[model samples]
Target: MTDDTAVQARRREIASEHLLFKLIEYVEQRHPGLLDFLEGSLDHLGDPAHDETKDDEAVRQIARQMITGARAEIAE
Candidate 1:
């Protein structure tokens, strides 16, 4: 891909992630403990694809942990 293409792709990725976190915040505000429930439900899905998406999966794992950490901080 061209440098411009890669930059645009990354911008879209960041925007998508921002939208996701905003949605998560909306759900948590509307449903209270529901985000925690959803996070717990995703535990079974943490399996590695063991392929090219491993890096993406790793980043997602970090995002998941970040959400958990943020919740923990809110609790404190």
Candidate 2:
């Protein structure tokens, strides 16, 4: 891919993650009971839904590891 395409892709990735965090925040606010609900859901879930578009394997691996760690922490 061209440098421009790569940059745009990264921007999109960052935006997606930001949106996710914001949604989590919104859920927590709207339902204070969701602290446990969030943790429980994270524990039940595995990695991100898709790993195919992850042309950048390094970023994909990092995301997987982070998600795994978060899930483990939640379980504890």
Candidate 3:
């Protein structure tokens, strides 16, 4: 990759790390048990018998809501 492309990728990586830290802080403060629940849900989703389209959609919606809530919290 060109130097500019490499710089842009690095910037994205840093931004992602920042967001991840913020999300962790938010979860720890506002929803302490949520991380465990998400971990369990993700493990369940990996099962072949649990691969339902409706379930995937529901998870996506829940994730979107979590992200929205986190963003709002960060803004405050």
Task: Write down the worst ten-residue block by lDDT for model 2.
Answer: 40-49
lDDT of candidate 3 over 12-62, digit per residue (tens):
988986687587667767766655565456534532344454465565565
Which stretches of model 1 miss by more than 4 angstroms?
46-60, 69-76
Candidate 3 TM-score, C-alpha based: 0.42
The residue pairs found clashing in candidate 2 are none
Clashes of 1: 0
Instruction: List runs of model 3 lying over 4 Å from the truth.
Output: 41-76
Top model number, lDDT: 1
Off by over 4 Å in 2: 33-35, 41-76
Cα displacement (Å) at residue 31, model 1: 0.5
> Compared with the true structure, what per-residue lDDT tens digits does model 1 show for residues 1-76?
5699889999998898778767777677777986677667665555466876656556558767868855664455
Q: Which lDDT value does model 2 have at 25?
A: 56
lDDT for model 2: 0.58
lDDT of 2 by residue, 1-76 (tens): 5699889999998899767656655665566565555544543454443656534545445655654554454445
How many residue pairs collide in each prediction?
0, 0, 0
Local distance difference test scores for all models: 0.70, 0.58, 0.63
Q: Which candidate gets the maximum TM-score versus the true structure?
A: 1
